[model samples]
Target: MATKMVGFVWAFLIIIGIIYALLSGNISAINDSILTNANKALELFLNILPIIVLWTGILKIAEGSGLLDKFSSLLKPGLSKLFPSVPKDNKALGYISSNIVANMLGLGSAATPAGLKAMQELQTINHKKDEASAAMITFLVLNTAGVTIIPTTILALRIAYNSSSPSIIIIPAILATASSSIAGLTLDYYIRKRNK
Candidate 1:
């Protein structure tokens, strides 16, 4: 439903823009913009494609080499505390750890499969199928406020755009994401405690 609404909004805005451009006798400008932006978008996508592919390959290698499992093991204790309802041996925890690790490295696209798998695994244990479980809500909060230590996509974009200091965003992104994660977890904790 939200996706449909967003699609409708984009369509409405595009229609409005076309009508305004026609009335203002700036249809030529609109045409030029469409072509220019399309080219630029394609250029940007091509530039970022290699970086995404490289990171995704590395992620796969980590998984195959058991590095991801080792990382997940390190995260399990803290994850168990956060999601007490989930059984310690549940596969959801493993997927959640992989998703979090991928996100931390700024590979959101790479993390998506693990995130989806985690949600599915979480759902299997949900007592109330119609309503989201508290663990699910907490996971949502954590994913939304994901603490990215490295903003790989943004760095790639900066590099593509010829930024002289692409890595300069590293510290600020870490600080912002860490703060948001802390705030979100704190709020979630209090809300759950109050509900109990």
Candidate 2:
């Protein structure tokens, strides 16, 4: 459904752009951009590929060393409060912890796999697989409002663009994400209580 919506949006944008270009007599520019967009996308992918590989490798190492498990254990107490529906010794908790940690470090691309795995684990215990469970909603809220300590992608982009203070937004990012997370969790709790 989301894929279909996105496709519609892209199609709309392209049609609108072409119409505007026709009206403005910039058809050549539009054609040029259409031809070059793929190359630009490839270039961007090549630039970000090394960072993705490096971070994925580091996450793999952490997994091999049992570091992720150790961290998950440490988070169990607090995370249990947030995810009471999940089993005490569930595999879902580990993936959730890993996802949170990766997001906190601002490794968005690296967090994707763990987040997906977490959802998969979450679904196993869901009575209605077609609908989201309470724990799943809570996890989605938390992940969507993730607290980023590093803002790594933003910093990397800034550095690539030759910013004088590439890392200056770190503090602001942390504060904003923390605030968002707290607000999101509060609302989730309120909704859950109302439902009960």
Candidate 3:
């Protein structure tokens, strides 16, 4: 369904672009827009890389210092309620903690591996071959709606575009993420309850 929607959107955009090109009697503007967007995207990527590397390194150091482990331990009781099938000492707990920590710091690239590891571990505990387990679904919801403290990617783009006070977006980012997280968790709980 999502793929179909994407296809429809792209097709509509192409058709609209063609109509605009014909009515405006200029295909050059389309080419110019494409080139400009591509250049802006490249600039944004370059600007973000340094921040990504720096944050990932910091997270690595924190991981080595056992800070992430401590954070995991602190959250373990609550997490256990969400993932009852997983043992307290399970590697998935570690991965989930690291992923959440990285995300909180707005280091998504750094978090990807840990998130994947957590998902894989969750899958291993799932007995059904074709369907995802309740824990897996809940984890997915938590991740999708996870709160971001810094919103590093957006801040990088804003800085690249010469925005003043890029850090000001942090409050809004927190609010948006908090709302989504609450909604996603609520829906997940409702669905799981219904399933039972």
Candidate 4:
């Protein structure tokens, strides 16, 4: 897997190099762009750290206060119906619910650990020897196409770039993410049905 990933990266770099060579007749443009972009990337990353930390810290407080569990319970009935394979009492369901809630609020830092735990719990429940179970696949799809609200990371980037209306992206981000989530789940359902 590591080798395959490395190979893919090399292939991607080769493609980019070809494009750069064809356009500029030299690699100097690419070198300069890489140096400039690396600095910008680092600055952007630093700018977002405070936002991520604040949100994740809030999530920890919510979890400790048991508010997350209460919210999870409120959401559980519908989620249970959607993910029939996951038992109501299962830890995976709790983790998944927390992860989803965090993602919906655009708290990626907060969602990471919960999502990892959910995946671990899901892997534990897999009865099959060779492949992922339907529930696991569905969860992966849901996580990948998460329903975002604030889009905090993008907002942070916008702010770093000195955008005036960073928060104005909220509505569009919510709509776009919600639509992607619906599409992902719908596709997962069809695939699961076809496989079954």
Highest TM-score: which candidate? 1
- Candidate 1 residue pairs in backbone clash: none
Better of 2 and 3 by TM-score: 2
lDDT of each: 0.88, 0.84, 0.82, 0.82
Which 10 residues in a row give candidate 1 its minimum summed lDDT? Answer: 147-156
Q: What TM-score against the true fold does each predicted structure earn?
A: 0.88, 0.83, 0.81, 0.82
Q: What value does the lDDT take at residue 13 in candidate 2?
A: 98
In each prediction, how many residue pairs overlap at the backbone (N, C-alpha, C within less than 3 A)? 0, 0, 0, 0
Better of 3 and 4 by lDDT: 4
lDDT of 4: 0.82
Top of the candidates by lDDT: 1
**Tens digits of lDDT, candidate 1, 1-196:** 9799999999998999999999999999999988798889888898888887887787788879988779868998999999988999999998998889888777787688999999999999999899988999899888889988766677789998899999998888789888999999999999999988
Question: Tens digit of lDDT per residue, candidate 4, span 1-196?
Answer: 8799999999999788869786888877777876798798788789998887777787788879988778867776777777888887888988888888888777676788999898888878789857888988888888889887767678888888899888997888778888988999998889878987
Q: What order do candidates take by lDDT, descending?
A: 1, 2, 4, 3
Off by over 4 Å in 4: 1-7, 22-24
In model 1, what is the error at residue 171, expressed in angstroms?
Answer: 1.2
Stretches of candidate 2 off by over 4 Å are: 57-61
The residue-level lDDT of candidate 4 at 183 comes to 93
Model 3 RMSD in Å is 3.2
The all-Cα superposition gives candidate 4 an RMSD in Å to the true structure of 2.8
